[model samples]
Target: MKYLNLALLILFPVAWFAPLLRAALLPIFGMDEISVITGLQSLWGSDPAFALLVTFLAIFAPFAKTLGLALIHFGLLSPKTLPALHILGKLAMAEVFLIALYLIIAKGAGYVTIETGWGLYLFTVCIIVSLFISHKTETS
Candidate 1:
Protein backbone atom coordinates (compact mmCIF):
# COMPACT_ATOMS: atom_id res chain seq x y z
CA MET A 1 0.00 0.00 0.00
CA LYS A 2 2.85 2.35 0.74
CA TYR A 3 4.47 1.60 -2.56
CA LEU A 4 1.16 2.05 -4.34
CA ASN A 5 0.62 5.45 -2.78
CA LEU A 6 4.16 6.39 -3.72
CA ALA A 7 3.50 5.23 -7.28
CA LEU A 8 0.73 7.80 -7.46
CA LEU A 9 3.37 10.51 -7.19
CA ILE A 10 4.43 9.56 -10.71
CA LEU A 11 1.17 8.24 -12.15
CA PHE A 12 -0.95 11.25 -11.24
CA PRO A 13 1.21 13.63 -13.22
CA VAL A 14 1.08 11.40 -16.28
CA ALA A 15 -2.68 11.23 -15.89
CA TRP A 16 -2.82 15.03 -15.80
CA PHE A 17 -1.34 15.40 -19.26
CA ALA A 18 -3.17 12.39 -20.61
CA PRO A 19 -6.11 13.21 -22.83
CA LEU A 20 -9.32 13.16 -20.82
CA LEU A 21 -11.71 13.90 -23.61
CA ARG A 22 -11.82 14.38 -27.37
CA ALA A 23 -14.36 17.00 -28.28
CA ALA A 24 -15.46 18.35 -31.61
CA LEU A 25 -17.88 21.20 -31.86
CA LEU A 26 -18.80 20.08 -35.33
CA PRO A 27 -18.59 16.65 -36.84
CA ILE A 28 -16.75 18.00 -39.87
CA PHE A 29 -13.86 19.26 -37.82
CA GLY A 30 -11.11 17.32 -36.14
CA MET A 31 -11.72 16.68 -32.49
CA ASP A 32 -9.48 18.44 -30.01
CA GLU A 33 -7.98 16.32 -27.28
CA ILE A 34 -8.55 17.77 -23.84
CA SER A 35 -6.32 16.64 -21.06
CA VAL A 36 -6.36 17.97 -17.54
CA ILE A 37 -3.61 20.36 -18.46
CA THR A 38 -5.29 21.55 -21.66
CA GLY A 39 -8.65 21.89 -20.00
CA LEU A 40 -7.11 23.90 -17.18
CA GLN A 41 -5.41 26.12 -19.72
CA SER A 42 -8.69 26.79 -21.44
CA LEU A 43 -10.47 27.41 -18.16
CA TRP A 44 -7.76 29.73 -16.90
CA GLY A 45 -8.19 32.02 -19.87
CA SER A 46 -11.96 32.11 -19.89
CA ASP A 47 -12.91 31.27 -16.32
CA PRO A 48 -10.32 31.54 -13.65
CA ALA A 49 -12.83 30.56 -10.97
CA PHE A 50 -13.61 27.20 -12.48
CA ALA A 51 -9.96 26.74 -13.36
CA LEU A 52 -9.01 27.04 -9.71
CA LEU A 53 -11.72 24.62 -8.63
CA VAL A 54 -10.61 22.08 -11.21
CA THR A 55 -6.94 22.55 -10.45
CA PHE A 56 -7.64 21.85 -6.79
CA LEU A 57 -9.88 18.85 -7.38
CA ALA A 58 -7.92 17.26 -10.20
CA ILE A 59 -4.42 18.05 -9.00
CA PHE A 60 -4.12 19.36 -5.47
CA ALA A 61 -6.58 17.04 -3.76
CA PRO A 62 -5.10 13.75 -4.94
CA PHE A 63 -1.55 14.95 -4.62
CA ALA A 64 -2.16 16.02 -1.04
CA LYS A 65 -3.98 12.80 -0.19
CA THR A 66 -1.19 10.70 -1.70
CA LEU A 67 1.45 12.67 0.13
CA GLY A 68 -0.46 12.33 3.37
CA LEU A 69 -0.65 8.60 2.88
CA ALA A 70 3.04 8.46 2.07
CA LEU A 71 3.89 10.26 5.26
CA ILE A 72 1.71 7.90 7.25
CA HIS A 73 3.29 4.90 5.58
CA PHE A 74 6.73 6.19 6.47
CA GLY A 75 5.68 7.11 10.01
CA LEU A 76 6.44 10.74 9.31
CA LEU A 77 2.84 11.75 9.86
CA SER A 78 0.14 10.59 12.23
CA PRO A 79 -2.65 8.33 11.03
CA LYS A 80 -5.21 10.61 12.61
CA THR A 81 -5.04 12.71 9.46
CA LEU A 82 -6.55 9.87 7.46
CA PRO A 83 -10.05 11.19 7.73
CA ALA A 84 -9.11 14.51 6.19
CA LEU A 85 -7.20 12.71 3.47
CA HIS A 86 -10.28 10.68 2.73
CA ILE A 87 -12.17 13.89 2.18
CA LEU A 88 -9.54 14.93 -0.31
CA GLY A 89 -10.00 11.67 -2.16
CA LYS A 90 -13.71 12.36 -2.36
CA LEU A 91 -12.93 15.77 -3.80
CA ALA A 92 -10.74 14.12 -6.39
CA MET A 93 -13.64 11.88 -7.30
CA ALA A 94 -15.77 14.96 -7.80
CA GLU A 95 -13.63 15.99 -10.73
CA VAL A 96 -14.48 12.75 -12.49
CA PHE A 97 -18.14 13.44 -11.88
CA LEU A 98 -17.74 16.90 -13.33
CA ILE A 99 -16.21 15.46 -16.47
CA ALA A 100 -18.95 12.89 -16.86
CA LEU A 101 -21.57 15.55 -16.33
CA TYR A 102 -19.97 17.73 -18.97
CA LEU A 103 -19.89 14.86 -21.42
CA ILE A 104 -23.51 14.09 -20.80
CA ILE A 105 -24.58 17.67 -21.22
CA ALA A 106 -22.55 18.21 -24.37
CA LYS A 107 -23.81 15.03 -25.96
CA GLY A 108 -27.40 15.79 -25.09
CA ALA A 109 -27.18 19.37 -26.30
CA GLY A 110 -26.43 18.05 -29.76
CA TYR A 111 -24.01 20.25 -31.68
CA VAL A 112 -20.99 18.96 -29.84
CA THR A 113 -19.46 15.53 -29.99
CA ILE A 114 -17.57 14.39 -26.89
CA GLU A 115 -15.71 11.11 -26.58
CA THR A 116 -14.20 9.71 -23.41
CA GLY A 117 -10.47 9.41 -23.77
CA TRP A 118 -8.06 6.95 -22.16
CA GLY A 119 -6.86 9.62 -19.79
CA LEU A 120 -10.24 9.80 -18.13
CA TYR A 121 -10.03 6.14 -17.19
CA LEU A 122 -6.44 6.56 -16.11
CA PHE A 123 -7.25 9.49 -13.87
CA THR A 124 -10.22 7.69 -12.37
CA VAL A 125 -8.23 4.54 -11.67
CA CYS A 126 -5.56 6.53 -9.93
CA ILE A 127 -8.13 8.14 -7.66
CA ILE A 128 -9.80 4.83 -6.87
CA VAL A 129 -6.43 3.21 -6.20
CA SER A 130 -5.47 6.00 -3.86
CA LEU A 131 -8.74 5.60 -1.99
CA PHE A 132 -8.22 1.86 -1.72
CA ILE A 133 -4.72 2.36 -0.41
CA SER A 134 -5.96 4.84 2.15
CA HIS A 135 -8.69 2.49 3.30
CA LYS A 136 -6.28 -0.40 3.65
CA THR A 137 -3.79 1.81 5.39
CA GLU A 138 -6.40 2.84 7.91
CA THR A 139 -7.59 -0.70 8.49
CA SER A 140 -4.14 -2.05 9.18
Candidate 2:
Protein backbone atom coordinates (compact mmCIF):
# COMPACT_ATOMS: atom_id res chain seq x y z
CA MET A 1 0.00 0.00 0.00
CA LYS A 2 2.77 2.43 0.83
CA TYR A 3 4.44 1.52 -2.42
CA LEU A 4 1.18 2.14 -4.23
CA ASN A 5 0.76 5.52 -2.59
CA LEU A 6 4.26 6.41 -3.66
CA ALA A 7 3.47 5.24 -7.14
CA LEU A 8 0.37 7.42 -7.29
CA LEU A 9 2.30 10.49 -6.22
CA ILE A 10 4.86 9.79 -8.89
CA LEU A 11 2.14 9.38 -11.47
CA PHE A 12 0.65 12.82 -10.79
CA PRO A 13 3.63 14.82 -12.06
CA VAL A 14 4.18 12.62 -15.09
CA ALA A 15 0.53 12.89 -16.03
CA TRP A 16 0.67 16.64 -15.68
CA PHE A 17 3.70 17.07 -17.92
CA ALA A 18 2.13 16.38 -21.29
CA PRO A 19 -0.38 19.20 -21.18
CA LEU A 20 2.06 21.40 -19.31
CA LEU A 21 4.70 20.90 -21.96
CA ARG A 22 2.30 21.51 -24.82
CA ALA A 23 0.86 24.63 -23.28
CA ALA A 24 4.35 25.95 -22.70
CA LEU A 25 5.82 24.91 -26.02
CA LEU A 26 3.03 25.34 -28.57
CA PRO A 27 3.26 29.12 -28.95
CA ILE A 28 7.06 29.18 -28.75
CA PHE A 29 7.30 26.38 -31.29
CA GLY A 30 5.18 28.35 -33.80
CA MET A 31 2.13 26.19 -33.33
CA ASP A 32 -0.70 28.66 -33.28
CA GLU A 33 -3.38 28.20 -30.65
CA ILE A 34 -2.30 24.68 -29.87
CA SER A 35 -2.87 24.84 -26.16
CA VAL A 36 -3.77 21.56 -24.56
CA ILE A 37 -6.57 23.08 -22.53
CA THR A 38 -7.96 25.42 -25.18
CA GLY A 39 -7.15 23.13 -28.06
CA LEU A 40 -9.81 20.73 -26.87
CA GLN A 41 -12.26 23.58 -26.67
CA SER A 42 -11.39 24.87 -30.13
CA LEU A 43 -11.60 21.42 -31.59
CA TRP A 44 -15.07 20.57 -30.32
CA GLY A 45 -16.91 23.80 -29.52
CA SER A 46 -18.35 23.97 -33.01
CA ASP A 47 -20.07 20.64 -32.77
CA PRO A 48 -22.75 20.30 -30.13
CA ALA A 49 -22.01 16.61 -29.65
CA PHE A 50 -18.32 16.99 -29.13
CA ALA A 51 -18.88 20.10 -27.13
CA LEU A 52 -21.12 18.22 -24.75
CA LEU A 53 -18.51 15.53 -24.35
CA VAL A 54 -15.84 18.09 -23.54
CA THR A 55 -18.16 19.90 -21.18
CA PHE A 56 -18.89 16.73 -19.29
CA LEU A 57 -15.22 15.92 -19.01
CA ALA A 58 -14.32 19.39 -17.90
CA ILE A 59 -17.00 19.31 -15.25
CA PHE A 60 -16.01 15.93 -13.88
CA ALA A 61 -12.24 15.98 -14.16
CA PRO A 62 -11.63 17.99 -11.01
CA PHE A 63 -14.18 16.07 -9.05
CA ALA A 64 -12.40 12.88 -9.94
CA LYS A 65 -8.95 14.22 -9.12
CA THR A 66 -9.92 15.75 -5.82
CA LEU A 67 -11.86 12.73 -4.78
CA GLY A 68 -8.74 10.72 -5.41
CA LEU A 69 -6.74 13.18 -3.36
CA ALA A 70 -9.27 13.02 -0.61
CA LEU A 71 -9.09 9.30 -0.46
CA ILE A 72 -5.35 9.30 -0.73
CA HIS A 73 -4.86 11.50 2.30
CA PHE A 74 -7.92 10.68 4.33
CA GLY A 75 -7.06 9.18 7.71
CA LEU A 76 -3.50 8.79 6.55
CA LEU A 77 -2.36 12.28 7.38
CA SER A 78 -1.71 13.43 10.93
CA PRO A 79 -4.80 14.58 12.75
CA LYS A 80 -3.85 18.23 12.60
CA THR A 81 -3.73 18.21 8.84
CA LEU A 82 -6.78 16.07 8.20
CA PRO A 83 -9.25 18.94 8.19
CA ALA A 84 -7.13 20.94 5.81
CA LEU A 85 -6.79 18.05 3.45
CA HIS A 86 -10.51 17.51 3.58
CA ILE A 87 -11.18 21.09 2.65
CA LEU A 88 -8.63 20.89 -0.09
CA GLY A 89 -10.33 17.79 -1.40
CA LYS A 90 -13.58 19.67 -1.67
CA LEU A 91 -12.02 22.74 -3.21
CA ALA A 92 -9.59 21.17 -5.63
CA MET A 93 -12.26 20.29 -8.16
CA ALA A 94 -13.57 23.81 -8.49
CA GLU A 95 -11.20 25.48 -10.93
CA VAL A 96 -11.65 23.29 -13.97
CA PHE A 97 -15.39 23.00 -13.39
CA LEU A 98 -15.82 26.73 -13.28
CA ILE A 99 -13.71 27.26 -16.35
CA ALA A 100 -15.59 24.66 -18.31
CA LEU A 101 -18.93 26.00 -17.23
CA TYR A 102 -17.99 29.51 -18.17
CA LEU A 103 -16.78 28.40 -21.56
CA ILE A 104 -19.89 26.39 -22.29
CA ILE A 105 -22.47 28.89 -21.05
CA ALA A 106 -21.09 32.41 -21.31
CA LYS A 107 -18.64 32.18 -24.17
CA GLY A 108 -21.22 30.25 -26.21
CA ALA A 109 -18.50 28.82 -28.41
CA GLY A 110 -15.60 30.07 -30.56
CA TYR A 111 -13.55 31.39 -27.64
CA VAL A 112 -11.94 28.09 -26.56
CA THR A 113 -11.77 24.42 -27.49
CA ILE A 114 -11.70 20.96 -25.85
CA GLU A 115 -9.19 18.44 -27.10
CA THR A 116 -8.62 15.96 -24.16
CA GLY A 117 -4.87 16.16 -24.44
CA TRP A 118 -2.55 13.37 -23.39
CA GLY A 119 -2.00 14.92 -19.97
CA LEU A 120 -5.68 15.06 -19.24
CA TYR A 121 -6.03 11.41 -20.18
CA LEU A 122 -3.01 10.47 -18.12
CA PHE A 123 -4.23 12.43 -15.15
CA THR A 124 -7.52 10.63 -15.28
CA VAL A 125 -5.71 7.32 -15.28
CA CYS A 126 -3.52 8.41 -12.39
CA ILE A 127 -6.55 9.43 -10.38
CA ILE A 128 -8.10 6.03 -10.89
CA VAL A 129 -4.93 4.25 -9.91
CA SER A 130 -4.61 6.47 -6.89
CA LEU A 131 -8.11 5.62 -5.81
CA PHE A 132 -7.31 1.95 -6.07
CA ILE A 133 -4.20 2.47 -4.03
CA SER A 134 -6.12 4.41 -1.44
CA HIS A 135 -8.63 1.66 -1.05
CA LYS A 136 -5.98 -0.98 -0.73
CA THR A 137 -4.06 1.09 1.76
CA GLU A 138 -7.08 1.79 3.91
CA THR A 139 -7.96 -1.85 4.31
CA SER A 140 -4.54 -2.95 5.50
lDDT of 1: 0.93
- Per-model TM-score, in order, reads 0.96, 0.43
lDDT per residue as tens, model 1, 24-139 = 98968999999999999999999999899999999999999999999999999999999999999999999989988988888997789888899999999999899899889989
RMSD to true structure for each model, in Å: 0.9, 10.0
lDDT of 2 by residue, 1-140 (tens): 54555565566546544562222222334423233345456647667786565544443443444444445555544434434433443343343444346435633444433333556556656555644544454455
Give the per-residue Cα lDDT of candidate 2 at 122: 63
